[model samples]
Target chain A: MTSPEERLQAAQQVLASWAGDTQSPEPNRLDVGVAAQNLIAAIEALIGARWGYLSAITGLDLGVEAGQIEVLYHFCEGAAVLTLRVATPRASASVPSVCPLIPSASVFERELVEMMGIQVVGTPDNSRLFLADDWPDDVYPLRKDAVLERGVKEQGNE
Target chain B: MSEAVVQDKKRFVVPIGPQHPALKEPGHFEFTVDGEIVTGATVRLGYAHRGIEKAVESRNWTQSLYLLERICGICSHVHAMTYCLGVEKLAGAEVPPRAQAIRVLVAELERVHSHLLWLGVAAHEAGFDTLFMYSWRDRETVMDLLESFTGNRVNYSANILGGVKCDVTPDLASAILKGVDFLEERSRHYLNVVTTDEVFLQRTRGVGTMSKEVAERLGVVGPTARASGVARDIRIEAPYAAYADFPVQIVLAEAGDLEARFVVRIKELFESYRLIHEVIDKLPPGELQTRMPRKIKAGETISRVEAPRGEAFYFIKSNGSDNPERIKVRTPTLCNMGSVVATAVGHQLADMPMILAGIDPCFSCNDRTVAVRDAAGALVTWESLRQRRLAHQENK
Candidate 1:
């Protein structure tokens, strides 16, 4: 029932303590940049206040040139959507798990782990969620330059 | 199959499928059971994961629209519609009011067919074949209307990037009105049958009753959340497409059981029928196609639409080029899948099929036949298997 602007303002206040830089790319959306250390605090703030449901988690590869991956946690309330953005260096891309707070988030976290090769620290399940068993380790399928197949040794009825 | 996944050697865990667990879809579930009662459960999906999100990155704007529509066979229009709305937002393109209304019309038609299909499937799961047969038989009216109107039965490619591709002629409008009139009467009859049928009620009444708190915590969407009083329909709350022009009343049920899910979805059928008639009567006059840029501006946008299942969420990012930089799709089934695992913990194994059908899980939207293997793990040939079955039939 509340307006999208009003909901984003409320979310902005709740996440103010941890947000570094904030931007509104569209009218109904708010993007907040949060440090990796403060990620849980920001998520807890939104969920604690019942701001919205955790909609989806998007893993964006800035590219091989940028050597950084940005993890966006999107939360939607009616018409409003608030995203908590965290950028990690590609070499050491890791974010603390939010599954301790929201159990349903394990699916999203698993996706980030398998697709972007990001280390989701302390997630409840660390197994492969989508990739095949024979899929080589350290090969993330969603990376910008990810090869479809390479280094697959044939097993001749071993 | 192993103690590692279950984490206890003494425990007896029953793995339902990487095959048909209940519905003919491909999802694997492990239900930890003691006697007839289940204690805990886990589900493994992606048996048919097509990886559309990754595939779209290599495609241009126009090409991806067709590819995204293949995400689900049933609710194809919503995917194309969601992508177009996000792309239009990024390009700053304006679609005509008539085009928007047509989009809603096709969307509502798609919803009608989806709900009726779910009704038949749910009935079949409950071992009520008469309802299954009757509902699917009546579903042909909407299916026929869709085929005649949109030119396809399943993937009605009715949407282009800027606007819609189909137009409703006078004859098409009359046909739709007549078709939906029949469907409305059939739907009313179904509502009575589901509410009053004592045998059907026993299978659905109190099974998998999730409280409002659990529903929220699990974060179910669409009819599943609405059945538990979540009040989170994107059509009403956000009003994408022409939903603003023609308002949608959010249907709600507080029981949160399998029966509540049935009732909520059936009630939503009536809402779709009403919207179809409204859009046809107040059909705006304008262009169906709007000019749009091949290269969208550099911006990131989120588009959400209320699909028949729930909120079909698409996040689109353009890099000032023809192709997209990144696109993420989170289907409603992905959001509501967790609830099935959580709710299956305390029910009898016999009730598993109905409880699983309660969510109307669409695993990858692909259909296939079962692969039967013998005791020694050798695959059974279809011809030999068929002949053996025929011989046994004659012997019995």
Candidate 2:
């Protein structure tokens, strides 16, 4: 297996612009912050080059003060994890769906939609995956501002 | 035939459990069928959603470990161990070498129990009740050892924040060795049963066949992908805990059918027994637990562990508080569920149970939310879900 540093360098060469600010916090991990618009391009570059498989997609709420939510697309090969960090304003949070390039992404994208309230633009299927049909609308439980009363009310109705 | 009769052969839907005979767990599945062959499949989960991910946020760093352990009953130790590994990494705490080895030892034993449990379940689905009974009866040997070692059978809670909670005593280690010897012999017989039994082979030899490429494309993990010849084990790839010290052999099967899944799991039992023996023989001597800070430093980290089902991915972000900012759990079943749905299509309705169980699905571990909306964008209730399932069942 190639060194994780070399893998990171190769990933940087694939994305010609804004490749300078990559962070290596732990061993075999490369984290790069990119604009929400460039999230799809960065991921396509990694997948096309056969860098790694999509391990997980984690959405983070920076809270009300920050007013922005971040999405981390983790690509893993062996022990190496190359993460693409994409941030969007929580007011109109949205990200381009990567399902067309990777079909398995539909499940994670649907999760982003329902839990974080982030609209996944162009995802083929956003059907209720693991949630009860009675789960209330506009209340993303994983979101920072998710109300407990809403989830409780929904449960009571059920 | 008549032309009208041919036209009348319309596709109908068959909705299996959120509560059906096919699955022991509670999860809904609707399969569109045409003349006993499945055309499409859809799944609805969250019947067992405990909101653990969200609830963990409200609890403190240490408290969340116990909460996370309850995520899956079968792989509870792995759940806690994975969480502890991530939290420790984020907190900048180092786990002692002996603790790491102990963690690996328990994890391997859990693997034995889980695979045996799966083998029995898959056999039961294939109408091989005798093998089911035999495998499950053999599984208790591992379970008993786990209880004697950790004091609990199902959720051992053996793993703590920094390291493991329980230490392996001389008596316990010898007892485990004796149990391993018994299991190794039984596993060989099981391997022979699945590979050579003519009737069992008929049910699994060609059913749910998946190529290596399809398995990789669907992101299947653990033994499921390994059976298809995809070498994606996390322990081998990223040697966490004591894996770097004592490596385990990777078991592979060429054919990606149900039988391959069986062979891969059965073969893994041999590998686990070998690893367990190695761990006990080289049982390290040191402190079982490590010291930790009350407030974790502000940071985020990813912990990937090869749970019995597959890769249990944990993403933990700490905001310099006692409580975590966010914890995202991407379970293996979530990845393999796509493959199951895809494989279910075009297979005989009778083989659907074996195919779904072949992946060893754990709906409770993979449980999350799905938002079903109406014309006004309102949420659909559980009553409506039951009605929809009933309507489909009535149609059949």
Candidate 3:
């Protein structure tokens, strides 16, 4: 079995391949994405020898700047933490759920759905986790340009 | 005779609360009970949601330190410590040795205060007001000591981003040592009361029992997991601050019941005292705070510190700004609350309070609300009705 550092190096190699010129970014972090299906495979391949725990998945709302949504995956192997950033266009921001490979990602994905209006394709139970059932669908509160005053007032009354 | 007369039985529903004497915060739980046993429960929260995460976005790194301190009153220092560590990691600032020692001392002191408060609450839940008063009185000594050192009792706010705001003077260290002595003696007395007292044993021993396997699978931490024979302590696994230098022993138990949790917490008080003494004895002399640069470059870091209740995690993302672009807090109570469902599944209705208190859960942080629901899902307040039933039984 490959050691955790070896696996991390391999993963870094794989990420570097995809990162092209972006490889060897400052702080030794990289941003890359595979197809929704290949995402889990890449993670498994990267997390060799070490137990990879899905730390969290956060959804970033780019609004019109990138005309897309970016989902960040935080993975931890022992003490070493790494981030994998993936973007999907606003028109089609759906991504495959990693719950099959990492069970803890389910709650985070659900939270992303409630907070940023991102769709997690193949989520087992995509019901409301944090937000109430009656919360407006169009309002994504975490977006950079999200209207805070109105959301705060409406939530305050509820 | 039974075959001749079969009647369809209807299910009953009861609502526990959005407000109740049982809960300190407003949250609702609907329980479907089948003749004194809770068959099913659904929890509703967000009643006390203060938009803390959103609020952090607007506040500067310095101002946000105070905001995070209020996330939960019990583990205030832990919140500040974790937040400070995250920002420190981002800014590449290293805390001084003396500051780290002081931070560890305060953190352990906070744990003692929190555990003592928990004991009092647990005693109060069991209708033992005398024990409750004694425990709280002892707990006040630690709080007074904290006030003497930091100038505030609850929030403390002693931690800055790179280091601590307050320094422990020689006089303050002596006073803390004296306070620890008093707490150690009183804690021993309290332990005896909890262990040998017939009433406490009867009320807690087998009630809300969580098996080792169940506790592990649910990812329970701190006393709740320790009581179930799981040796998972973030302090031991990943030590930050002075913990990395002076390693403290992790307390564990095997029973996994309310009694076991009580023991683990009580034992932890002694461990905290030992740790505080260790930190104070090996006090180093150096600068308190390190100078952090004006701007933090775009980076993400995950930090975990062992809070009084369990492992508390902070994830901070900086976008080359003075303020954090994103901040996420994962309190231990959130993980420990899952085991409550499993433990309380078969417990008696009367044992609910003690069982719920066993985890020493910070529901205020966990977003918990209690609502009593009957089998058919109707809301009801059982306290008044239970009192009426008692009166009727007394008359009969």
Candidate 4:
């Protein structure tokens, strides 16, 4: 029954313990930067307080130059969107699977593992969701510096 | 996990393909059975993965719009409109109210057509071809209206960067009203059949029931979650486009079974019919297009739109450039797909296909990809795309 603003304020209060740097990108959106270690605790807090449902998990590569891969876990309550931003080193990109907290997160984590080449420790299944089985490992196509071959060849063209 | 007698080390698995006619998409599902009762189930999708998310990172603001539109054949307008709304939100461009109304109008029409298509498919899966045939035949009414109104039927391309492309003319408005009227009556009959038909009810009732607790824990979305009585509709909870101006009530069912899924979707059709009429009758009067900058400012924006199946979420990040830094699309099918695996357990193995269809799962929606031929798929210039299309046509 609370308004979106009230809900968002409540989220800010919930995550106040773990959020490192909080920013309001939009009027209804709250962006909280959390260390990779604190990501789980912050998420547990949100769900524990019944803040909102996890809307999506977005993986971002800050380009080859930045040497950082960022994962955004977005939770939505009404029109309010609260994002938990976690950045990891590109070479050993890893995020503790929130699947332990949110089982549905396994799907998003699987896609992230293959697409962005992030290591999601403790995910139920690390199998490919989009990439082919014989596809080369460690070549994350979504990475800014991924070396993608020409368009997929037709079955006979090979 | 079931009360049914468990056989020692029994793992008789039934695999429904990455290509099977029963479940019409390129998804592989495995169900472990013990004496006709499913013990455990797992689904593997993405056979048709198109690499579109990776492709969007390379394409500039506008080209990505058309690519995102094709994310789902059934809910293409929602994809396009959601992209437009995200891009506009980042660019700080204001879409005209009239254009927003048209966007909602087209979105509601898409919802009606999508629900009808699901009804037919679910009916077919349940071996109720009579209802299937009738529903598919009646679905053409909305299809024809969409084709006439938006030009193409499935991927209508009805949305532009700042606003929508199509407008509701007086002629089109009258035609749409007439079309919805016919659909309203047909939808009522189908609803009655799905709710009351005894034979069909046998397949759907008390089958694959998902309680509200299970629905929330698994994070199922759209009609599937609503059927479980989870009040999680993006349209009502977080109104976007013109949904704010014209609102629709949330549809819910307590049973949380295949029948409830049927009831929830059919009831939604009536809600859509009302929204369509509301948008057309109160068609805002103003310009349809707004100016957008070539290079969008650096920012992060999340746009959540309620697609036919569920909530379609988009996360767009721009590094103050023409091309997006990162674009992530989390379709509703992915959210509800988990529920199928969780609920499929303990049900009769024969009911697997019907339970799968209850969520109206779209594999291609979850498997979005781009046909990249170069370093970054973003180098696909419009001219090259046109040349490729021309070559493809000549080859055909």
Question: Which model is ahead, 2 or 4, in terms of DockQ?
Answer: 4
Task: List the DockQ of the predictions in order.
Answer: 0.44, 0.48, 0.19, 0.53
lDDT of 2 at B152: 95
Give all candidates' CA lDDT scores: 0.88, 0.87, 0.73, 0.88
lDDT (10s digit) by residue, model 1, range A86-123: 99998889999999999998888887898899999999
Instruction: Grade the docking of candidate 4.
Output: medium
Which parts of model 2 have CA positions greater than 4 angstroms off?
A18-21, A151-158, B1-10, B368-396
Worst 10-residue lDDT window for candidate 2 chain A reads A149-158
lDDT of 1 by residue, B201-234 (tens): 9999999999999999998999999989888999
DockQ leader: 4
On TM-score, the candidate that comes out on top is 4
Task: Tell me the TM-score of each prediction against the true structure.
Answer: 0.92, 0.92, 0.82, 0.94
TM-score of 2: 0.92
Residue A80 of model 3: what lDDT?
44
* Deviation of model 2 at A31, angstroms: 1.1
Q: What is the TM-score of chain A alone in each candidate?
A: 0.92, 0.90, 0.74, 0.93
TM-score of chain B of 4: 0.93
lDDT of 4 at B156: 99
Judging by lDDT, tell me the better candidate of 1 and 3: 1
Summarize candidate 3's per-residue lDDT along A39-151 as a digit string, tens digits: 66666655453344454566766557778877777654434445676777876677888766554355567667766778898776576655555667776666666664544
Task: Sum up the clashes in candidate 1.
Answer: 1
